[model samples]
Target: SAENVYKADGTIAKSGKLKTGFTAVIDSRTYVIAVCGDVTGEGNVNSKDVTLLQKYLCDNAELDGAYLKAADFNLDGEADNRDLVLISRQKN
Candidate 1:
């Protein structure tokens, strides 16, 4: 089966380069694909992504696929306070 790509907010993803945090729904599954550090899916790395990662750490939000991978700023095979600190330092 095939379906249109979707954003995390459930909207059809705009036609353009797929960046970090930009979500996709395919085959009845949802995934965040491409890049790293753009957890908010706005096509750029910034403070907003940092905030979202913070919320995720506190159990206030959810991140999967590439979103989770991006949060792994240190490539330590997990997203944690260390990754959070690194992400915080990189945000624009």
Candidate 2:
């Protein structure tokens, strides 16, 4: 699964093989949970996400920290055309 759990500051809190009843405790703060490529947080990755990534790459839109993390398909700590193409080819 591409799902990722992130803390409020947009850093990954946990990842890989998440199971049911998984839990974590942290100081009072918000968190962002989403799939790696699901930048829109729609619980799935699809063509719409591809479009959003394209927009972000073309400077037609902005991606906040969490969304930027999700859009970095190669997990290389950057979002660019390579990531955009990876997102576009995502099967889910």
Candidate 3:
């Protein structure tokens, strides 16, 4: 199953860990993937993600599937202030 996953560049994802803002092809189906804390979906976890998460918390912006998942930095099934705080502390 792991071999069926791939990175956005169409290369085999050796570690099977796809980063944010990239796509993953699994069993031939393409899926937009996300990295924990990289809610802004720009491929890295940083201040931008923090700002976006703040807006999302206040309903000022929207985070679709992948982005939303990324926002849930702790994988707690939901994005909230807690996750935002944790993401803020994460280094790229």
Candidate 4:
């Protein structure tokens, strides 16, 4: 279901199942962007993202380049509990 629900560029269109009878219009002038704190690359912020940040903080995992940017929710040049807090507040 997730595979059938993505945009033309292949990112997940929404957090969960697509509602029946719903229609989406793509704006050619604009691009769908990944939300900040989407460290798991799921295109939405959730507990999984927070877990990734936690893993990175504990040195159990590492993030670099684009992943690093996503993990840095505060844009303060580091990944920490503050970023985790921000991400925790985000709902699908």
Candidate 5:
């Protein structure tokens, strides 16, 4: 069975990253980093959801939704933004 991390809204009660390390099977090729990090699936990555990611890392908080479905910016089962460098690189 799949493991549960957080709730549906955005409250996290755990203190560890979930297991999301797996290569997706692409036809005739292996996709290494095709994981989706949109979290809320709002499209065109924006501040609304980034706030939640910041909250979890900076505020030591947790979102009530599934970590994989929300804050896991890299889809590696962690609320980190390594893939979000562009988010930080852009001028404010």
Candidate 6:
């Protein structure tokens, strides 16, 4: 079902490239896919996600992609180490 989405108003979400998620045939002819809850970005969010999150926590160390994302688990369009502590309290 990774096809295009067509609205009754003649709007189309078109895309020349095909991907795993939904292809929106409306919003600028692109995909309207949602990568939800993928906090780890390892393709899926699961138990091992915490490890990825921890790697990002800087210990007077260098910066990396995982650190960037981990510092801000919610991805509220910002990166702050404060978010990391919040995520650490998760059961998973």
Q: Who wins the lDDT comparison?
A: 3
In every candidate, how many clashes are there? Answer: 0, 0, 0, 0, 5, 8
What is the overall TM-score of model 4 with all chains considered together?
0.60
Of 3 and 4, which scores higher on lDDT? 3
lDDT of 6: 0.44
Candidate 4: segments with Cα more than 4 A from true spot: 1-34
- lDDT (10s digit) by residue, model 3, range 33-58: 78889786566788999999999999
Q: Of models 1 and 2, which has the larger TM-score?
A: 1
Q: Which candidate is the best by TM-score?
A: 3
Model 6 lDDT per residue over 1-92, tens place: 53456332345536433222333555456543333333443344455444544554545333344335444556685544555555555524
Clashing residue pairs, backbone N/CA/C < 3 A, model 1: none
Q: What are the lDDT scores of the predictions, listed in order? A: 0.77, 0.68, 0.79, 0.65, 0.43, 0.44
Q: Could you tell me every candidate's TM-score relative to the true structure?
A: 0.66, 0.65, 0.73, 0.60, 0.38, 0.35
Residue pairs with colliding backbones in model 2 are none
Residue 77 in candidate 1 has what lDDT?
88
When 5 and 6 are scored with TM-score, the better candidate is 5
Candidate 1 lDDT, 7-72, residue by residue in tens: 656677658766775566678886657566777767777899889999999999998887788888
Off by over 4 Å in 5: 1-35, 40-44, 83-92
How would the candidate models be sorted by TM-score, starting from the highest? Answer: 3, 1, 2, 4, 5, 6
Ordering by lDDT? 3, 1, 2, 4, 6, 5
Reference-based lDDT, residue 51, model 2:
91
- Location of the lowest summed lDDT over 10 successive residues in candidate 4: 17-26
| lDDT tens digits by residue: candidate 5, 1-92 | 22333332344425543322222334545332222444443433466455655666576655544434444544565556664553444313
Those runs of model 2 whose alpha carbons end farther than 4 Å from true positions after fitting are 1-30
Give candidate 2's TM-score.
0.65
For model 2, how does the per-residue alpha-carbon lDDT over 1-92 read when each residue is reduced to its tens digit? 22444444455646454221222344544344445787776657788888988898889999976678888879998988898888888846
Residue-level lDDT of model 4, residues 1-92, one tens digit each, is 12234543455557563322222445533322334677776656778888888889999988775567777778898878998898888846
